[model samples]
Target: EDFVGHRNGAEEFVIITTLSFGPPLHDALTRRLTEELHSFYNFMERDQGYVLIEDGSGKQSQKPLMSAHITVSQGEPDPNAQPSKAASTSDDPWVDASEDQDQKPDSSKPSGSAFDW
Candidate 1:
């Protein structure tokens, strides 16, 4: 995913990778995979995302378990930004950096992550 950021010029663009996972989620094994999804792919706020479960034939059935639209930005979201009535902040899986940060200037924490589920 590539998009112009808050930067003044269109020349300044952010490029992030997106990965679509299909089939079998939220279960114990799937939870581990989800962590790897965060560890390996490393999706950011600007990135697009998708999740669908595969059928017995190993093909996606066109149903989404998660989506980029649901994963709110970790960066400064617009004050007016609000989740739709059907979706609340609690439903979002992405954790904000602010919640886990330490007061020290050099607090030990990863600079990037897809986010913890």
Candidate 2:
């Protein structure tokens, strides 16, 4: 996996590579992963808040398992930006509708069909 950090136009990359197998490859891979995470964490800590821009996975040459990329940018989000109309007007019942009082359970469908036997 590769995690790239961008701050004020500067870019830093951290790559983690691991071989397949259970206990035989565990320690080294874990150590490397931990080191890379700490390095990225320190970089982000120095740069402050960052927003994730992209994430994807694909085949890589060095390792048998597929590789992944995660990109983060230090650019600040627009504070004055308005929500999209489609998003604001969304009628989907599940999203942010926990407090809604108008919804009622349907009585027409049997409640326990799986237990009917």
Candidate 3:
């Protein structure tokens, strides 16, 4: 049996599929298709911004597998938009204190719990 699904958006579509076969063949087929799908996704994400692969080979070692492809388009930002302001010195102190707090949990609270929780 075969199954397919997809989602829609302004610039792209995603398609996924699954196929079934006997246990031995299914395992092998699934493994191969899964590897191919991973490679395909990497290529699409890096090169084409899309993915396309066939799903399922009914070999005795194959299992169920899913495949997908996509297309992406780059959009330009507004030229007239104002650039964001740089953070002031006050903001820097808050950021530094936040990092210090993260490194050291509050000793006033019990070891496992937070003050609010």
Candidate 4:
């Protein structure tokens, strides 16, 4: 459901994504999600940057959504660096709740699509 465009007969192309959510998230979660979305959108909308919102409207069609035009500079790759994973973040209530229960994971069992955290 994603499509990228190549324009001006150049090697550079713009990336377009279609993000979907199966269910509506609560307002408490919206702030974090919206901030992350803006961060990602801004990164992609930088100099040599391109942005287009062909169909951005969604559950909140009445509200206006902002488009970004940012300039990003790529930094040299770090071999020892690691990317942050949301599931491992401190903000995850699920992880905290599970920790409170103090139940260790059953490593012997195979994981499935609808397994617990």
Total clashing pairs for each candidate: 2, 0, 17, 1
Cα TM-score of candidate 3: 0.21
Candidate 3 deviant stretches above 4 angstroms: 1-21, 43-117
| Tens-place lDDT digits, model 4, residues 1-117 | 544453321223443443332122233345664575456445546432445534445332222233323322334559898996766424443333324543544455444411221
Cand. 4 Cα-lDDT:
0.41
Off by over 4 Å in 1: 1-26, 45-47, 50-117
lDDT of 2 by residue, 29-90 (tens): 66675566445434644354332323246533321221223432334559999986553323
- What does candidate 3's lDDT look like per residue over 17-90, in tens digits? 33223344456666786676555345535355433433466433322223533333334569999998766544
Candidate 4 residues lying further than 4 Å off, grouped into runs, are 1-25, 43-117
TM-score of each: 0.18, 0.21, 0.21, 0.18
After aligning candidate 1 to the native by TM-score, how far in Å is the CA of 30 from where it should be?
1.1
lDDT of 1 at 22: 17
Quote the positional error of residue 21 for candidate 3 in Å.
9.4
Every candidate's lDDT? 0.36, 0.38, 0.41, 0.41
lDDT tens per residue, model 1, 62-113:
4322312212232444889887655333554332334433333322433332
